[model samples]
Target: MRDLVRKYKDFLAVKGVTFDVPEGEIFGFLGPNGAGKSTTIQILATLLKPTEGTAVVNGFDIRNEPDKVRQSIGLVFQDPSLDERLTARENLYFHAMLYNVETTIMKKRMAEVLEMVELADRQKDQVKTFSGGMRRRLEIARGLVHYPKVLFLDEPTVGLDPQTRKRIWEYIHYLRDKEGLTIFLTTHYMDEAENCQRIAVIDHGEIVALDTPENLKSVIGGDVIKISTDNNEEVLPVIKNRLQVKAEKQGDYIAIQVEKGEIFIPRLAVELKGRINSMVIKKPSLDDVFLHLTGREIREEGVNAVDRMRVYSKRKH
Candidate 1:
């Protein structure tokens, strides 16, 4: 989207964000609650209009050619959109009809997608009888009924068990690799974002950082050394002056970033001696990158409807 902006009267939900996704690449939008990730996705999916700017999805203008844009893209929403009473095959068949797929090819397409999601055998069972993961897989199968070029997965794995989430990603990867489908997704899960080819970190209606996970973490320097000490007041300045490093005091601990944490630990051990209470060193993470850029943690918990309305209300006036 170029110069995209969404305003609810006065509240700015998305601020002139611009980015591109190449065909067949898995692109991710990563952020926390109230961060406008969903708002941006809505614009791209033709579900909402942008106050300013334009986007071209599969060569169709999102504003003037919304129908064409809708035709070329498939959307899997955060909430369950499946018909609980319908069998999986019936649901897929209904979607195929709604999308105007040729009747001759509908059965073939249903079989292909069902087999892709590995739900062909259970296609006769009601959706309510399937597990959460199975339901999600069927939803994805439904999205593929018309063979969309680009798929938008909004928080696709929310509320599922870890194993289920992993299985969902395996299917996602299979789609991109085997079917050559371009995938764009929004997620709050850090580990989930790592699976994407690249990610844009959004917060408070803006893109603060965008890059691959490795490159984003590299921007924070090297390994992270977190120290818990009883004498932070005494040790903070000593470490800074002697080591020429900056240390951030975070509540009960001092967080220091260095090129080589393991190598530096011996020096710290000898210099501080008995003064050190506890310390641990490890590699930087996407969470560290978010913290480095935003100075706050991207909330892992999903926001409720009331909280969403409250954010909207705050933005309006």
Candidate 2:
């Protein structure tokens, strides 16, 4: 989508943002909560229209051909979207009917999807009785009933256990490899984003960075050294003057980047023997990349309803 925008009255939920995904590629929109990731996905999936620009999903224009767009794509929302009273198989069957899957093959497709999610034996069980992971898997299976060209997964693994999250990723990879399906996913979990082929790091409705996980981490340029001291104010200048390294104050610690963090640590210890309290050295990560770009952690709590309401009020007047 080119220059896509979405406004909720004066809130401006999504800004002018644009990017494209290759066929059959797993592209991720990686961001913290409420960074416009869901809003962009909603527009591309044709559930919400763009206020300024447009998108094409599976060769169908999201605006001019919404029905075609809907036909070509499947969606698994962030929240559970299943009928608790219905059995797992019944849920899939209902979804198949809504998507107009051929009745002749619906049963076969239902069985296949159930088996794919490893829920075949439990297909007869009511959805309310299933665990959280099982429900998520069932929802994913339902999304594939009609064989969509692209699948949109919004926080697909949220609230799932580590084992369950891993299994879900296995199923996702299986679908991509077997069916050659294109997957567009939104996630706040950094670990989940690492599984994607490419990622767009968004903040405040803007793409701060876009690249492979390795490439994004490489942008940090070296190892990270974090130090804690009783007098951060006293140590900051001494380190800069003696080591000729720029250090950033983060709370009660100082963060420094160097080619070799281990070597830097020994030097730091020798130079300032009694002043340091604690220290850690490690390689760069996605969190570091985000902090480097935004000067704040991505997971920081964002604007609240009252703040948005203030903006809305100003716009109304």
lDDT (CA) per prediction: 0.87, 0.87
Model 2, clash count? 0
Per-residue alpha-carbon lDDT of candidate 2 for residues 1-317, written as tens digits (9 for 90 to 100): 88999998977878888888999988889887777989998999888888998888999899999999989998999889999999999999999999999998898989999999999999999999999999999999999999999999999999899999999899889889999999999998887888999999987788889999999999988898989987999889989899988677765678887888877888999888888999988887777787787665555444764365345435654
lDDT of 1 by residue, 1-89 (tens): 89899998988989899988889999999988767988998999999999999999999999999999999988998889999999999
Q: Which regions of candidate 1 deviate over 4 angstroms?
A: 227-254, 267-279, 300-317
Candidate 2: residue 89 lDDT (0-100): 95
Deviation from truth (RMSD, Å), model 2: 3.8
Task: Please give the lDDT score at residue 222 for candidate 1.
Answer: 87
| Candidate 2 local distance difference test against the native | 0.87
| Model 1 error, position 255 (Å) | 3.9
lDDT of 1 at 270: 85
**TM-score per candidate, chains pooled:** 0.87, 0.89
TM-score of 1: 0.87
